[model samples]
Target chain A: MLGALKRLWHKLGSPRWFFALTSFWVSLFGWAALLFLLVGVVWGLAFAPADYQQGNSFRIMYVHVPAAMLAQSLYIGMGVAGFIGLVWRMKLTDVFIAASLPLGMAVTALALFSGSVWGRPTWGSWWEWDGRTVSTLVLFFLYVGIYALREAIAEMQLRARASALLAMVGTVNIPIIKYSVEWWNTLHQPASFGLTQKPAMPSEMWLPLLVMVLGFYALAGCVVLTRMRAEILHREGSARWVGEWVAGRRGS
Target chain B: MYFDSFTEFLQMGKHGLYVWLAYGSTALVLLWTWLSAQQSLASVTRRVEQQAQLAARNTQLAARNTMSGGAATGSEREQNLAGYDESET
Candidate 1:
C-alpha cells in the first residue's frame, strides 16, 4: 500500500501533470461554483422567505457565511502549502502559497466586513471584540504579514522560506478562530449552519446557503488557479522552453 | 413569496443599507481583487520578458564593441608601420 501510494504521489507531484490536472479541476469547480452561486443568490435572495425576526436582512448570511467559510479553509490551505514548501523545498508549493494570499485576504476581509454589517442590523453595532470576531481579525492580520513579509525580501528563495515559516506559525489561529464561540460566551452564534450536521433552517434557508458556499469556493478556486499559473510562468521564464511558450502564447 | 412588494424588500425591515452594503461591497471587492491580480501578472510577465530581451541585446552589443576595438587596434598598428617605412626610406 505504501508503495502504491508513493507511486501515486510521484505521478501527481509532477509539475506538468499538476498544471494539467489543476486546469481540469479549476474549470469544473469554476463552473460548478457559478451554477451553485447563481442558484444560491436567486434562491436565498428572491425565493426564500424572510426570517421572522431579522426579515430580509437575514439574507446577508448567504454572503457572510460563505466568505467566513472560505477564509477559514484558505488559511489552512496556505499553511499546508507552507509546510510542503518548507519540507520539500518545492518551488510550486511556495508559489501556490503565495498565489493564494490575495484571495484569502479578500475572503477574510469579506467575512469580517459582512460580519460587521450583519452585526449592526442584528446587534445594533458594527463591531465587536468577542473571541470569534477578534481571532478572525487576527487571521486577517496574519495574512497581511505573510504578504508583506514576502514583498519585503529581495531574494526570492529567502522570501519564500521566511513567508512560509510565518504562515506555518500563524496557523494556530485557525482552530481558535473556528471554536471561539464554543470556547467562550461570545456574542456570535455557535455553529448551526455546519456542513455535516443538519442546518438549523428550513430547506429554503439551507439550500441557498449551500449554493452560496459552493459559489464562494468556485470564486476562490478560480482566483487562486490563475495566480498559481502566473507564478509558474514567472518562475519558469528562465527555462529554454518558457521563452518559446511565452512567445507562442502571446502570439495566439 | 418573500416580500409583499418591492418596498418591503428595499426596506429590509429597517436594515436595507447595512445588508445591501455588506453584500455589495463583498461582491465588488472580489471583482476588484481578481482584476488587479490579472493586471499584476501581465505587468510581471512583461517585465521578465523585457529583462530577458535587454540581457540578450547587451550581449550582442558587447560582442560588437569587442570586434570594433580589435579592428581599431589593427588599423593603429598599420598606421604606425607605414610611418616607420616612410621615415626609413
Candidate 2:
C-alpha cells in the first residue's frame, strides 16, 4: 500500500500524467455539480420548511452557507498546495495555486454578496464592520492580493515562489475568519454545521444544505481541474508530449 | 410545494427581493466562473496548438533552407541571384 501510494505521488508530480488523469474528472464533476445543485436548490427553495422566525428568507442559506464554506476551504487548500510547492517544488502544486485563485476570489465575492443580501433582511443592515464580516472581507482581499502579486511578477520562478509564500502566510486569516463570530460580538450567527454537535435545525432543513455544500465542492473541483489543465498547457507548451497531445487532440 | 402558489414561492414571505437577489447573484457568479474556466481552457488549447504548428513550420522551413543551401551549385546560386536582380529591376 505504501509503495502504491508513493508511486501515485510520483505520478502526480508529472504534469502530463496529471493532465491525462484528470481529463475525464472535469466533466464528471461538472455533471455531478449540475445534478446536485439542481436537486439541492429545488429542494431547499421549494420543498423544505421555512424558518418560523426568519420565514422563507432563510432559504438564502442554500447558496450563502455553501459559498462561505467553500471560500474558506479553497483558501486552506491553496495554502496547503503552496506549502507543497515550496517544500517539494512539485510543478502541479503551483499550477493548482494559480488555477484556484480566481475561483477562490469569485466564491469569496459570492459569499460576501450573499451574506450582505441576507443581512439586509435579518440584521437590518447591508454592511457591518463586525468580526465575522470583517474577517471574511479580509479573506477576499487576501485572494486579490495574492492574485495581484502573481500578476506583477514576470519571472516564472520568482512569481511561483512569491505567490506560494503569500498563500502560506495568508492562512493565518482563515482561523481568524472561522473563529471570528465566537471571539467577538457580531451580527452574524454561529456556524450551522459542526462536527461535535447535531445541527440546531431539523434534518429536513439541514439535509438539503448538506447537498448544496457537497454540490459546491463538486463545482469547485470541476472548475479548478479545468483551469489547472489550461495552466499546464500554458506552462508546458514547448514540451514534446504537449505537442503530441495537441496533435492527438486535433486528430481525434 | 411549500407555498400555496408560485407567487408565494417567489414572494418568500415579504423577503422575496432579498432571497432572490442573493440566489441570483450567486448563480451569476457561479455561471461566470464556469464559463471563464471553459474559455481559458479553450484559449490555452488554441494557443498550444498554434505554437505546435508554428514550431513544425519553423523546422520545415529550416530544413528546406539547409537543404537548398547545401545542394545548390555555384552556377545555380548565380542563376538565382540573376533572377532576383531581374525581378528587382
Candidate 3:
C-alpha cells in the first residue's frame, strides 16, 4: 500500500499525467454540479420549511452557507497545494495554486456578498465590523494578495516560491476565522455544520443544505480542474506531449 | 410546495427581495467562475496550438536550410530565428 501510494504521489507530480487523469473529471463535476444545484435550489427555495423567526429570508442560507463554506475550504486546499509545491517542488502543485487562486477569490467575494445581502434583512445592516465578518474579509484579501504576488514576480520559479510561502503562511488566519465567533461576542452566528454533532436544524432544512454544499464542491471541482488544465497547457507548451495533445484536440 | 400559491412563493413571506438577491448573485458569481475558467482554457488551448504551429514551421525551415547546405537566404534565416525566439517565450 505504501509503495502504491508513493507511486501515485510520483505520478501526480507529472503535469501530463495530472492533465490526462482529470480530463473526464471536468465534465463529470460539471454535470454533477448542475444536477445538485438545481435540486438543492428548488428544494431549499420552495419546499423547505421557512424559519419561524426569519421567515423566507432564511432561504438565503442555501446560497450563503455553501459559498461561505467553500470559500474557506478552497483557501485551505490552496494552502495544502502550496505546501506540497514548496516541499516536493512539484510543478503541478504550482499550477494548482495558480489555477485555484481566482476561483478562491471569486468564491470568497460571493460569500461576503451573499452574507451581507442576507445580513440586510436579518441584521438590519448591509455591513458589520464583527469578528467573523472581518476575518472572512481578511481571507478574501489573502487570496487577492497571493494572486497579485504571483503576477508581480515575472521569474516563474520565484513567483511560485513567493506565492507558495504566502499561501502556507496565510493558513494561520483560517483557525482564527473558524473560531472567531466563539472567541468574540459577534453578530455572526456559529457554524451551521459540524462533523461530530447533530445539526441544530431539523433534517428537512439541513438536507437541502447538504445538497447545496455538495453542489458547491462539485462546481469548485469543475472550475479548478478546467483552470488547472489550462495552466498546464500554458506552462508545458514546449513539451512534446503538449504538442501531440494540441494536434489531437485539433483533429477531434 | 411550502407556499399556498405561486405569488406567495415569489413573495417569499415578504423577504423575497433579499432571498432572491442572494440566490441571484450567487448564481451569477458561480456562472462567471465557470465561464471564466472555460475562457481561460480556450485561450490557452489556442495559444498552445499557435505555438505548436510556429514550432513546426521553424523545424521545417531549419531542415530545409540544412538540406540546402546552409544556402537559405539571410533574411529567411533571420525570420526563422525570430520565430524560434517567439516560440521560446
* TM-score against truth, every candidate: 0.83, 0.92, 0.94
DockQ of 2: 0.70
Q: What is the lDDT of residue A36 in candidate 2?
A: 92
Residue pairs whose backbone atoms clash in candidate 1: none
Candidate number with the higher DockQ (1 or 2): 2
Task: List the global CA lDDT of all models.
Answer: 0.79, 0.90, 0.91
What lDDT tens digits, residue by residue, belong to model 2 across residues B1-79?
A: 7889998988989999999998889889999999999999999898777777766665665576697776556665565
Per DockQ, the best of the predicted structures is 3
lDDT of each residue in A1-252, candidate 3, tens digit only: 999999999999999999999989999999999999999999999999999999999999899888888889988988998899899899888888898898899889988998998899889999999998999999999999998898789999999999989999999999999999999999998977788999999999999999999999999999999999999988888899999988898899
* Candidate 2 lDDT, A1-252, residue by residue in tens: 999999999999999999999999999999999999999999999999999989888999999999999999999999999999999999998899999999999999999999999889898999999898899999999999999999999999999999999999999999999899889987889987887999999999999999999899999999999999999998887799998898898899
**Which regions of candidate 3 are displaced past 4 Å?**
B66-70, B73-89
Q: Which CAPRI quality tier does the interface of model 2 achieve?
A: medium
Clashes of 2: 0
How much is the lDDT of residue B41 in candidate 3? Answer: 94
- The reply for model 1, stretches above 4 Å from the true place, is A1-17, A20-27, A250-252, B45-89
DockQ scores of the candidates: 0.38, 0.70, 0.85
Tens digits of lDDT, candidate 1, B24-62: 897697777667766766776776566555545545655
- Global fold similarity of model 2 (TM-score): 0.92
Please report, as a residue range, the 10-residue window in candidate 1 chain B with the lowest summed lDDT: B80-89
Arranged by TM-score with the best first, the candidates are: 3, 2, 1
Identify the leading candidate in terms of TM-score.
3
